[model samples]
Target: MPCTGQREREMTAVVELEAGGAKLGLMPDVGGSIAFWRCGEMDLLRPVSDPHLIAQHGRAVAGYPLVPFSNRVAGDHFRFEGVDYHLAPSFGGENCAIHGNGWQRRWGLDRLANSSATLTLDHAPTRDLMGQWPFSYRAQLRYDLRENGLSIGILLENTDTRDQPVGMGFHPYFPRHAGLKLGFAASSVWTNGPDHLPALRVPVEGEWSFAHMRDAGQEPIDNCYAGWSGSAFLRWPREGYALTVEGSPELRHLVLFTPPGQPYIGLEPVSNMTDGFNRPIIADSGVRVLAPGQKMEGHIRMTVTRC
Candidate 1:
């Protein structure tokens, strides 16, 4: 198990793995950031004022970016297989529910190695009751630390006898300074209204693009993209570190979110998409249809390199 940081008040645990002159800090709560992985700086991730920022610092489970459904689940209800599943509005909105109830839940930590650890989170059958969608599901998150890199694997197991439509994704905020460059490949992008719902699918035009490093700062993009090439890259040329995120072929979609004043950029790799219920993006990404007792898995791997 990684040792808890010397400062107990932080109340966060760190698992450090050293290789190639780089250390990986694995925080049990703050998701995965280089601070925990590389021992860079503490204040970089430990937010002092914003409770929500502190809440998201390094914890691994509780669903990183969003949950059972990322962004807004669209009234916590969706029609799947001709049946309507109404999920309670855990996110507290009129008809739109924001994020899912994954990050708020606790996850159990299993194996703890210097460079790796496995965390498991459960969604009881009752969790689905409030929303009208009922099913037993377990999500396991594994972080394998290696030299200058980390691999995050997610496994969603449907223990229910009836087939249910499921969605999951990672919402990691990459540290973005002036010297950072982000790159990814996508064929089409979705246009959205103020509510963050998909308004339409449009071809990648001039500036609202990720095909290359094309001024991601000037655009306001809270949208989903299909026909992704399956990989995304972020490079800090001045810092000499680059992080790579890739998903299985099944994860064919990506959500890029740029909030106006935030220092970090969110590159979300998801199995399904925002408002997938009405949009039904599962089929486009090869969303798995689990048998009575089956499991679906995907991974996001990152390698940090110092040039």
Candidate 2:
């Protein structure tokens, strides 16, 4: 079933996956985002039981796929292959295109099982969707349930006739506790400007540092760290367990969105940074241009265990 409209999110049916002490719920009609994830009664991602809530606010869902690109496109326009394309200000509150159209459109079930499923999204450029992304591509998300964990595999193919810049990742929302500590390694970070887009590239230091296990959600952060070690973990000292997030090497950037006062933290495994396509040094910005018919695949896995 297709998404009715922006406001009228008519839900089709939710796909449920269960195995190895894990339960996952996915709403194919609602941007194919994860509704809830639980491992033995413990919420892995921020669990949402209300289908209406998932339909209304996809941004608050447990997790979602970021495809064709991740994060913002900046300035509502970008120059590609010597031609300039202007992204319509699809973001209602801002004059920029953010987070691509994947997380807002509908996805179909390609296959399913007790613990494994595949969701597919075929996007042919449209005048409306072109406001956020003006490329033709097919995105496939393969979700597998593991013992006390879950794994997501993404495969994106450039279905366009011309070269198209592509990026992809998963945005998993994790519950943050008072004693939660995040551990990750990165060489540098892209600091956000007033517009919440990366304005400066700086070394990982001060509040931007996560090289060692440090308290998370205490300070506000919404930056994309480059040169990621391809893995990160959140340890809840008070809870006695840790959730480790591991991404494929191709997913070179990790976006940490720990908003102050918010109960959830988003540790996104992305292939590019905010506005990477518009960066001056595009070569080093993590954006890859895919030739016609070319495809790229990556995966992210999250496992839980006692600390």
Candidate 3:
């Protein structure tokens, strides 16, 4: 038989492993910002260029510009490592700065066979950053996708000879419209001002308790939970699935933000609490400082399973 000019192309491409009759779209470019990651057949992880997406996912990572720094002078102004650094206000502020420099830059892509992919981003302390938070450092974000979930690992290295304060956090926007619920095991809660920066540290209060399932619609937040058990349990009852977020013991804090008028919720696993720069350093708290030529690395794994 002679073949006609007709050909067929499938609509859905299998980007990664398959199980339970569902194909995973693990590494296809979703949009301009995020690489589309499907959790087996559970849900589609949409990556967008908009910052609001961070708010939409309930827990998308936010940094380099977390919240916004309103006051800044020439050279990005601040002092660290025994030096006065200046950083041009990326968001235009004059009083102080917010979030370190990381997210705004475009990261490089390194695909690892089929099971995983790596997103390598670099932040070389600019004269602006140097003038504000004076220190030479490198930041990297690595995303590894698997059959059941994805793990985000962050590494920050000190390139200068002096010790500097470093604060890193993960912002994940979780789905909220469904029967979504959040639960975690933690002991301390940091007090913050109306602007959402740390004001004090106190014992965990009622409702703030996350040892049990709590409806997403019932609570409002922009606060951090400290002395965590280093774990959190998240579930979408409507979807019949749950995700256990496991962090390193070094990752002692988790920030939960329930913004007004958003469909998603944020469950951020942070190495330090908000306004970390201005907050009093707990006996052993604050960003990890490494000696020159030294490196520090940590992991935050999110494992999802159907109920």
Best by lDDT: 2
On TM-score, the stronger of 1 and 2 is 2
Worst 10 residues of 1 by lDDT: 41-50
TM-score of each: 0.80, 0.91, 0.75
lDDT of all predictions, in order shown?
A: 0.63, 0.82, 0.56
53-156 per-residue lDDT for model 3 (tens digits)? 22122223222222111111223353445555554444332343444545444445555445454555444556544533456766555656666766667777
Tens digits of lDDT, candidate 2, 1-307: 5446734544635688998778888877777788889877578788533232322353446888888788878788889989899876645567777677777788988999999899999998786667657789999989998768899999999999999888889888888878889999999998888998887889998878888888885688888999999989889878777898999989989999887887888899999888988885756677888999999988999989976
**Candidate ordering by TM-score (highest first):** 2, 1, 3
Candidate 1 C-alpha error for residue 175, in Å: 1.1
- lDDT tens digits by residue: candidate 1, 1-307: 5346545434455556565545655544443322344524311121212233323433333226344555667656777778787766544335655555555554677777766778776666674345534677777878776665667787878877778666767766666566667788888887877776777778876765667864457355678887888888877666666677888865777888776666666788887766776765536733455666778777887666554
Instruction: Give the count of colliding residue pairs in each prediction.
Output: 20, 0, 36
The list of candidate 2 runs beyond 4 A from truth reads 1-12, 47-60, 280-282
**Model 2 TM-score, all chains together:** 0.91
Provide the lDDT at 185 for model 2.
Answer: 96
Candidate 1 residue 128 Cα shift, in angstroms, is 8.7
Name the lDDT of candidate 3.
0.56
